[model samples]
Target: MLTRLDLMAGAFRAGAALALSEPEIRGLGRLVRQGDVCFDIGAAYGMYTYPLAALVGPGGQVHSFEPLPNPFRLLAAGRRASGAERIRVNNAALGPAPGRELMTLPYRFGLPIHGWAHLRTGQRRPGRPISFSSTRTLKVEVRGVDEYCEDHGIDRVAFMKVDVEGFEARVLEGAARTIDSHRPSLLLEIEDRHLDKYGMTSADLADPLRERGYLMYAWHRGRWARVNSVTTARRNYLFAAQGGL
Candidate 1:
């Protein structure tokens, strides 16, 4: 059983793993260009969102989405300070369909952990380490990437950063059309420990992009190395279509 501190460390490691290094910034520069549209799905406090916003510039647009209310408020408020006027923050989660889903919020000192709130899959292992507060739940609105793009008249998305805990599969599942047609490069966080709650493997998350003619790569020591197989060795993966890469 993991303690609350252990869970916090896990969350910290997850963030550190997702952050782009100097070379990674350069590598992503090619895929994420100025004046191009981008998305930061599962954006918590705009970590990836602000970076995407910076790369896209004023001419480009970065759409950021966070389901939890606490993070959503922070994300929206940061827009003014970020002054990356092209960014639009939304308080909704992107899933396979449009509906409402209850998210079980993790807690530390009785406050909701910013990024630990995940969709209630009910598969949470019984007698799991730290107890999650049942009352600390929020029903978040869910939308599909395909529908959101269509509704917004967005034609081409330059890149997307998806780190929705274990729900990456469903998000991409809804994005099949978008990935097929627009061919945007993707940065994803895939961890089986989290995915297992939803009965998914890392391969299941990467397969969607693979089927769309995308290749996976891992950032190591300031260089991008092509990954031949899908594994959890690297928590963050860059999936790019040939056209974008």
Candidate 2:
């Protein structure tokens, strides 16, 4: 009884809701325990934040960062509505330093794709000239992880989920001290196409994480398989410390 247009609209409407994949939810459950300190970097709309808050329970806390104004509003509202008191929402971008930076936002039908917004960095220029008719840009506040953690007196971070699109390296660079101190397990999203937009290669991603003593793995088939390098083939990666969680 539904037309193609109707179905398409329905899908978009459904996407507006905050939800997480079963595998990621399972992974979080396995990695997080109650009372743990966790972070949701690039948390779009509380998809992972809600679940992480629930997993951490009353004693634990989950700090969620979302830069885009639109999504940040939604995330904050969701946090209040969910009544997940353990989740803290921050409305600033995380990078290697504290300042302001430009962010590129891809659009569709003149509307921004909230989940695809990414920070722009000077480290690498796009390999090829890239442009989209619907694309637009904005400036966002950027904060360093080390400074934020130190200022907040948060010394322990049990788990982190980073989906900064292609700026993962920058985010990690800012968090080096925190990474060194906490050695928290991370769920990172690495896509070659996205990285290429910034003239960066997948190696740029694997190198820093490796330097921090993280071994990458992909949840392939039914098991966690070791990944030696970042290829165009894979996206979501789970990085664990050598010692274990």
Candidate number of the best lDDT? 2
The residue-by-residue lDDT of candidate 2 on 148-219, one tens digit each, is 889888989988888887788788889888888899988888887677767777788888788878988876
lDDT of each: 0.76, 0.78
- Model 1: residues with Cα > 4 Å off, grouped in runs: 1-27, 121-135, 230-232
Top-TM-score candidate index: 2
For model 2, name the residue pairs that clash: none
TM-score of each: 0.84, 0.85
For residues 38-124, write the lDDT of model 1, one tens digit per residue: 988998876666666666766899899998887888888877655556889999999888889888777776676665567874355
Lowest summed lDDT window (length 10), candidate 1:
3-12
